[model samples]
Target: MLKKLEAQPHPDDANPLLRLTNLDVTFTTSTGTVTAVREANLTIYPGQTVAIVGESGSGKSTTAAAIIGLLPGTGKVTSGSIEFDGADITHLSPKEWVAIRGSGIGMVPQDPMTNLNPVWRIGTQVKEALKANNVVPKSEIGQRVADVLEEAGLPDAERRAKQYPHEFSGGMRQRALIGIGMAANPKLLIADEPTSALDVTVQRRILDHLQVLTEEKGTAVLFITHDLGLAAERAEQLVVMHRGRVVESGPALEILQHPQHPYTKRLVSAAPSLASQRIEVAHEKGIAVTDEELTGSGAGSVSTSEIIRVENLVKEFDVRGAKGEAKILRAVDDVSFGVRSGTTLALVGESGSGKSTVANMVLNLIDPTSGKVFFKGEDLSTLNSKDLFKMRRKLQVVFQNPYGSLDPMYSIFRVVEEPLRVHNIGSKKERVNKVVDLLDRVALPRSVMRRYPNELSGGQRQRVAIARALALDPEVVVLDEAVSALDVLVQNQILLLLNDLQADLGLTYLFITHDLAVVRLIADDVVVMEKGKIVEAAPSDQLFDDPQKEYTRELIDAVPGRKIQLAL
Candidate 1:
């Protein structure tokens, strides 16, 4: 029998900072009214950090939206009360909400691309937060913006502030959002998946800053995330929501260590940190396994042959300096790696570490400054335009952002069949059959084919992207941060789907991501990159068990909930 642990007591238990009592939120759509949250109850004392964890569409974000008074598209609190700092705030006027924002409560939303204004400069946006809150005088807004950006972990803050949202990477834009949210030093901060887009090292830095705010300023935080490992590591209280209801709530470590609810148990089991080491090593301990043993292939295996090879690859770009002078930026510097014909090789690194640049060089999407990429012993650069066009059929890529990659105007059927039509491989009827088969392989229903990309969820859209990538039967596929944005269950499904496809079709993968926990599950070998250079390379198990480089150790250490021991 599992033991039922009691909730941990807090010093400020007598005076709650934020409390949601029997809350119910609903959204009235064209069809009907749908309850997004039901009877949800939770409490956070002064300086307390509470995390709400669930799969996508489990009402975690809805609850946060209700608290912040930003419920979208006819969403409203139909019942219950939201008390903040001992005052009822369930229904505030527009002017009242404006006053409450920034100074009273700040928000860091999930999607940086949508939340940050594209037309405004990064520094100008940060200054708006300061000015709106009246935290500083107009004369001091410039320096305050720089300070906030630097504190949020962006280097060369002044220069970065001048750049637009398009100029910043996904991680940098997320950091800017964090800086804007924390600029006013509000009493309550709502961070909705704040660090989901960041690398582990930078994520640690951002969370550490939040910790400082909680400790020194007594700032309460309502954290919303899909990553249970991260929630356990950072939050004091944990609330589990499933199907628009709170399934479990209690102390963070205790609930995760010995979960009672079935949904919570499933989340605990699906977490990459707890379920690492999915790949089987079919050999004696400490003995290296053969290629055949690693991939479970027989005599027909292509593991011995190198399908893709990058030699001394270098890529450079021209950019403007802080002083408006032209400067050369070496994105990938003398990096080299090889992908075996029937294996998975993951490139793990932080943003701006040149992983994607290397992938681009291998895919022939961009020309390298120097060095060579060989496919089946043929140099890519030497190929003519016609040859390059034909080679694309043999090499395919699935980008990070599926919503951006997939055409919103095209139906799912057309999106998957586009590759076949472009390659002139089959007739219309034959292409339709191929699209259906591909969707089946990815575990998506045939009904989705009639719908468009906008109709599907994040996971469904990614599945559609994979189906398209596999339409041409490519021997090598480059998955660039493919599963980074998905929730755990969806990410696990995609990884398993990739593994099954690789086994069935003898596919090779060049997987690029910053997530080491997922790497442990799917990657056969690992290449660690730092600032456009390869710092370490080894088999997955060897690297995880005994990492040689200091940077590698730091990255592994940064994986949340790795050190926590959970009960079976």
Candidate 2:
């Protein structure tokens, strides 16, 4: 609602590059119809960064798709006008859109793997992308491709361009995707969750490139993501969406630093990577949580009743070099920790620290060459398949991307019923009843029972996934980056839900994450991990009050916006 009034025209649009007037996107289903975008009006200037922020179901990406004429087959822009520099381009046929998609507008899809042809060479694909937009003469295509790759900040651009997509790591793949997007230098770039899959360092590098390009070429950006921190770091303008509607829209700083909306406030409070800085500050000032504050803040009711314990856990992996011999990469080396019943033990670390490996071993998904995992004082490794299956119900997990974890083909009902069906623990009637009850507990409607994963938003899918994980009534829930991919507001809601569930169900948590902000909010005890080893372990209060390890201090220092004095 804010930007609609006073924002200046973007420098790149040349002349009001594109505009969406009273846009309405809808879909017609077999049983009924749904409106995905409601009177969504927008005016994007060339060379400006317009951040579309929202929870999973916020209709942000759908709006981007509509602008690009890439809506799903079942969906349609029933009533709206999409004008490119004053030309009404809303209803263009697919063939007509083909000419415009790459030349006039480019899209960097959310998942790099989804857009790229895994089998093709990266250079060849990039060359094709450039050629499709008629960027250069056929003779100069190869050189042009090299330039684009270098501009994208890839190492050994020429050599990397020759490699296949699979050869690139997650960060590299995203950069390669950016290379393709920049190939033709389209007037507008629609980046759907471009940085969601990247580490912070990589994310910062990529955003730097995007900023330079915008300033140099005046390319307007429509960045779609669930990360509010990222949106603040990059975009000048902001648009917040929820339940397929815009709840707030304004300058990025105003919305992020001084949000008036309740939803927006919650999102800011829940940003784990950012909010976790509270713990570091305490350590810096050597301030301990007082008895009254600890009790009031949730530490008073907690006790050290170890449900899971790891003693001198060691995990290693083999890597091969040109010599054709293997080198051991110690992923989890001599790590040790304990989880108390009805409390969370947070694992905080950087990428490649063996946090996930530790989680997998605890889940018994992977075998540890050495070390012992004691569950309820029993050796986990000694359990038989039958007993292991039973043990699984006592410990469950929630992954990073809820959408990817859930099957797109199955309805919410079937997805939630999976644990019951797998264990064959209940009758058909009993399972159905449980499914309905779990859905209600997760705050999802019964109407979603027949709805598929694709039909739900990011937050809704996560809720559905949470319900599924809770189906077995597990005592210990392993949330592996569970709230990492969500927008600030939705992430906070889920965290609160986890807290409530812990109180109601008497649950224990082995929360593995790179997000320190989460450690401040939910962790009863904290484990600082590095390269698969526990560098520090203490009660949350003590750890935050006085962190002794240098690595712990570094992790505390790495959080973005922690030192920045923000208004809100």
Candidate 3:
């Protein structure tokens, strides 16, 4: 039996800083009225840190949006009262919301790409927030921006301030968003999946700064995320939401140790932390992995023969700098690796580490400046345009953002069948049948075939993308950050599906991601990259158990839930 973590005592008589009573939120959609949150009740004390965790479409984000009065797509609170600091502000006007938007309630939205305006410079955006809130004097705004950026772990803050969103990497953009969200030092901070795109080391730094908000500034934090293990480690209290209702709420660790709700139990079991623990124990016991231990697949028996080999791969691009001077930017330099047949080779690194650049080269999406790429011992450079087009059918790719990758104009049936249509392989009826089978393989229902990309959730969109990738019956698949945007449970499902597919079809995978925990769950070999160089390359067990490089060790230690052992 797992021991329960002792819950910290709270002052029962103290007034709550924020309280939601019988909160019912609904959205007016084309189909009909949809209830997002039903009779929800929650309370947060001043300076307290609480987490709301669940899979996508579970209403955690919806609840956070409601608190800030920024709910999307005609969502409104009905027959509910929201009291903040003893003030009933449930139905605040737009002008009224402006007064509390920054100074009283700060929000760090998910997806830095869409959150930050691309045309504006980093400092300009931060200064706009500070000026709007009147948090500092006009003369002191510049220095304040630097201070917040530095606090968010951006080095050389002055130089970085002038850079636009496009110039910054994914991690750097997230840091900028954090700096903007924390500029006014609001009373309450709502961080919605802020660090989901960041690597472990950067994630640790951002999380540490959030801890400072509660400890030093007496600011309460309402964290919304899909990683249950992360919520268990960071927050004092936890609320698990399933299908828009709170299924369980209690002390964070207590919920993990002894979850009463079936959904909560499923979440606890599906966490990558528990999977890593199982891998660690198996390695400690010197137990050879069996087929059952490897997600009902032959993932454990991946052969050692090379399927795709990259040698001295170098890619460079010409860029015009601030002064209109041409500069050669080396994206991938002298990097080399090989993916074994019927196995997963994970390329692990932070943003701008050239992981995606390498994947692009392997897929022949871009021509390399130098070096050689061999697909099944045949040089990619040697193939003509006709042969290259034919060879591409044997190689497929699933990208990070499925919504962006899939065309919105196309329905689920069109999206999955387009590849088949382009290949000229099947009749109209045959292609329709193939689309249904592919959707079934990815666990999507037949009814979804009529829906557009916007009609489905994030996980569902990713499944459609996977189904499309497998439509051509490719020999190799490149999954680039494929499951990073998903919650833990969805990520586990996708990883398991990939494993089963690899086992059944003997497919090869080139997995690229920043998450080391997920890499441990599904990867056969790991290649650690930094600044367009291979820092370390080893088997999954060796990389996790006995990493030889200091950078690798730092990344492993920075995993969010590494401190606590999950119950198996």
Candidate 4:
């Protein structure tokens, strides 16, 4: 940045909005002082989408957190000037932050579970948010909540408000968050990876809401996320940060087209979210790459003699819903899928489309209501305790949030060794060696062996989870959105690692994720689910080139830059 910075205000920039100058976030740890953000400077015009992009440790999320006064208790802005609508707000106290947070500035967090009160009704949450800053009167807050919820593109807002967070879907919860944020008509919205976990369909709607807000309401948005394609497609300006420093800043198009920074370039090429329509079309044209991948280098690694095979799967959950008594909700109805030796058949869908249910049935974590699950061509549902214990070694699952899955009390090595011990795979010393090798395979430093889960970053914790999952050397690994919580570069590295493991050990993968990029990159065959049924199933290239299902087509079209035709 120049000494004076680009001081040129657009001629009509008289209402020039929020600006941050010489911002630095620091923390006083027991060991020493850590500077998380170093002299970061940025400005957002009145009606622009100014995106701050970077990896996990890049300070992007932290910067947004600081702005909204929601940073960790240990963190504080050491030096900076935060000018909001021509007023300096950096020195504001906790109470002042509370007042300004909702009324003048709004923030949408990445995880809904964090911000949402599980016990509270959706309507009550929205009402409380509106009442917090006294933006709407107590008497009128209810109506305002419904209005804003609908404005956030939620249907049946009245009905939804009465329901709890668990009653609503993932997409609905996000919309509720947006509705709460917009309840006060905040001048600047700070969204931290607003749709990072949403499927392509829901992601489109979320971005559309954000885009329309800026266009119609002139809401100056400080969009913060690691999704570069999303930024390029929707943001007007882009700010690239790396290792807590600003590496590049310019127009979104220019930056995406010609990224001057190598880090930015790596992120750009690491994972392409753009759906390959041509691949689907070609596959429909009889071109086949999915089957080739289905039987490639990893094909023979899985014990073909037997692991999981589902035939005519039907799963029903007894949900004590609105119908008075317990009701049988068809979570998985007549769904058939298989995980053969060393092959991946990815399951993709919006949340509540029964993907998780399918995974559970496969794992025998939950029994199917009616159908039979065959493991090694035998009935898994009828397995005895000892048989189940033996089968655990052959099957493993990697959950979405690694930190949640891990035991904070255990060190990295101990965490990895638990599975080995549980399976009695080796002696104590052998288990240690296996843990070290697993860490290496996941690209995690063995030095982290002594560290706890909380000591590691999000990416590192996820790596630990992957390492733990591979500890048993299982023939099948069921990854449930394993890489969704990570940044693009790290996500790519994990995908590559998965590929390498499959190639080396011939492990089978039942990859369950909503990310089209991951599916495109690693999946052999694609299974698109809608309302508990497979709507589209074909080889990856073929499905992308020519989607037979309307839902699949909509999903491809929902990708941010898919239609723009970027130069690869």
Clashes of each: 0, 6, 0, 13
Candidate 2 residues 223-334, lDDT tens each?
9977776676567788888777777888876786678888777666666654554344454566663432221134534566789998788887777662333477778898
- Reference-based lDDT, residue 459, model 3: 84
- TM-score winner: 3
lDDT of 3 by residue, 22-96 (tens): 888999989999999988788888878889999888899999999999989899998688999889989999999
- For each candidate, the alpha-carbon lDDT, in order, equals 0.85, 0.80, 0.86, 0.78
Question: lDDT tens string, model 4, 301-413?
Answer: 33344356778888877775446445778888788766656777789988888988999888889888888888778888788999898888788999999879999899888
Q: How far is candidate 3 from the true structure (C-alpha RMSD, Å)?
A: 3.3
lDDT of 1 by residue, 1-568 (tens): 1111234476754788789999999999899999999999998887778899999999999999888889998999999999988899999998888888887788999889999999999999999899888989888889999999987779999999999999988878888888898888888899999888788887876787767754566778889988898888778789999999999998988888789999998788677755552222222244444442232222133366899999999998887553334477888999988888898889999988999999999999999999999999999999999999999999999999988999999999999999999989888899889999999999999999999999999999999999999999999999999999889878877887787899899899999999888887778789999999999998787788789999999988788776555543
In model 1, pairs of residues that clash are none
Which segments of candidate 2 are over 4 A away from where they belong? 1-14, 31-34, 74-78, 86-88, 91-99, 257-302, 318-329, 382-393, 400-474, 485-489, 534-564
Ten-residue segment with the worst summed lDDT in candidate 1? Answer: 292-301
User: TM-score of every model?
Assistant: 0.88, 0.81, 0.91, 0.87
Candidate 1 regions off by >4 Å? 1-8, 11-13, 118-127, 134-176, 277-302, 320-326
The weakest ten consecutive residues by lDDT in model 3 span 1-10
Model 3 residue runs over 4 Å out of place are 1-7, 30-32, 93-96, 158-163, 281-299, 322-326, 446-448
How high is the lDDT of residue 375 in model 1?
Answer: 99
